[model samples]
Target: MRELDVAKLPEYVEEDVRVSEWSTVRVKHCAYSVPSRLKGKWVRVRIFEDKIEVRFADVIELACERLIGRNLCRIDYRHVIWSLIRKPGGFARYVYREEMFPSLVFREAYDGIQVLQAGTKGDLEYLRILHLAASTMEADVAVALSLLQMAGKAITSDAVKEMIASSSTSIDVPQLVSPAVRLSEYDALLTEVAA
Candidate 1:
């Protein structure tokens, strides 16, 4: 066979797409969410077998698992939470509302918020908590939510933030001391073995 070109053919198919106002790009009939900053911007997408990578100025900006079927969506809360925070009311009827919950704990927290505060107030509170999770560590926020729910405390973004702050401040790292090393013990063991 003749020698291949200097550069090998890319395994992925590349295409240029414009990010929709909702910060999503339609690929293969499926919508994939990108960063909010990419809204209305043209980006290059590298579609591989299992993942799609979005690049701006040849720098990868987003990479996520490719959707398998038509009309499916892969929405990440972090990518859309900022916009939702600005208009919390939209959350109730948002098309991919269920996908907004990053985990069962977050969903439970939202339900708990609803129980404490009804209607739009609860939605805003839940959105705030979600925004906090998107900005900080989700596991930390989840643990704080679990603790508050277990303790029968009000579940609010501020309360979760306080819980996280308290937990972080209370961490006690034990001081470690290195033990002294003695060559004499090893020498005695060696002498005994020789004898």
Candidate 2:
């Protein structure tokens, strides 16, 4: 058997992709979301086995599980939640709306909001909740939703936010104590030197 040179092998393929207006880039015929702030910017996409990593200005922005088939989309709701909060009306027509629901709890929360409110109001409320999940701890949001669901209360965004806030524990700061300095130690050292 012959030995192969390490430098002759290519680790991955790089492609320069322009992030679309929707905050996504096309790679392997599929769309993947980048950070919303990175829209209208060029990103270097590194295609690796089992994942596709997107980088902007040498900093890794995000990585997605590469899709095997064509025309598929992988979206993280957190990546675009802020824009959706500003324009809730766009949810209905958003191409990747289905991917926004990260879990069943979030889906159920959105459904509950829709049942309680009407039209764009419900969408806005759900977007706010999603935004909260994106901004804060998602596990905390899930716990809050669970509590709200058990209480048979409306799962509005404000309710979820309050529940999360109330459930969080406040940290106590400890007072600093300065150690006393003894001048006698220095005097003893001077006396020993003089002797």
lDDT score for candidate 1 against the true structure: 0.92
lDDT of each prediction vs. the true structure? 0.92, 0.88
lDDT, candidate 1, 75-192, per-residue tens: 9999999998999888889988999898999999999899989888999999999999999999999999999889989999999999889888899999999999999999999999
> Model 1, poorest ten-residue lDDT window?
3-12
Q: In terms of TM-score, which candidate is strongest?
A: 1
**Pairs that clash in candidate 1:** none
Candidate 1 root-mean-square deviation in Å: 4.8
- Which sections of candidate 1 miss by over 4 Å? 1-10, 173-195
| Top of the candidates by lDDT | 1
Worst 10 residues of 2 by lDDT: 165-174
